[model samples]
Target: MHIEDLAVPSVNMVRWGAPKQWLFVTPEQENVRAFEEKCRETFPWRKQARRPQRAATHCSQFVRHANVLVTTEALLDWGIDFSETICREGELVVTLPGTYHQVVNMGENLAEAVNVMWGNCGQVQSTYVCCSRDGCGHTGGVSQEDLTPEVASQ
Candidate 1:
């Protein structure tokens, strides 16, 4: 459940993976809130850790729960509109900025991805916290002190 770099689009080529499932959702506040709520409900243990929301990266709890595969019925119940696709071998998947996405490999497979920034890139790099390339250390994006239940709720 993360957005790729705002300045770059992620291009993934499925060289061997067949039937890879890709899910995407447009970044909307209501959708994000619903997703976070679902995550919290799914993994109640994480509530004690007091970790800040790190939607930009596949962090611990979220990564574990991502395998649960939210059903289409649940998405509709939550009012979350999404798009999905199945990529097979020799297929290419392109992901644009500001779109939250998740991928599930149906079986063991190999794939490669690269990020490219072009003239049409819209958002500034600083708009979203990128913990992948930047030297943000292990603590994804937000600090622990910055996110309380109250702040996270808002």
Candidate 2:
């Protein structure tokens, strides 16, 4: 629903709401660790996960709490004659969240980024719109509708 432009190798903020904005940057092990500490200093009770993609080549067939891919080089030149292009990298196309957005690293060098997610303690659940994928469909935002006190701790 929003677009952001950032200079290469710089940190960019993506505001999810209130104090939940994510600061995305290239994966620096130290910075990633420090950022986690800061998030905990504020919300000490939220569960978190920070890990590397299983494959050093292409990403696996799965999803994360959120993603911040750090491409030191260009991405693959794939065509998207379908789907609405919501964001771009200097005219190169990129997919937005809620869509089946996948990427392939074009450079032979390794690329990296750090992803941080909170509220994973049964407080939020992933929800999709029309359909998961294929044909006309786009996923919706994560939902907190089922987080009644009784269900939250389950």
lDDT of each: 0.60, 0.26
- Over the stretch 1-154, how does candidate 1's per-residue lDDT look in tens digits? 5555433568887788556899877557687667757666665554333334444234423423243556667667777778899988889998886566778888978899887555545434343433332332233566543433344345
If candidate 1 were superposed on the true structure by all CA atoms, what would the RMSD be?
A: 9.2
lDDT of 2: 0.26
Which residue segments of model 2 deviate by more than 4 Å?
Answer: 1-23, 48-86, 89-154
Question: For candidate 2, lDDT tens digit of each residue in 98-139?
Answer: 222334433232223322222442222232212123211222
Best by lDDT: 1
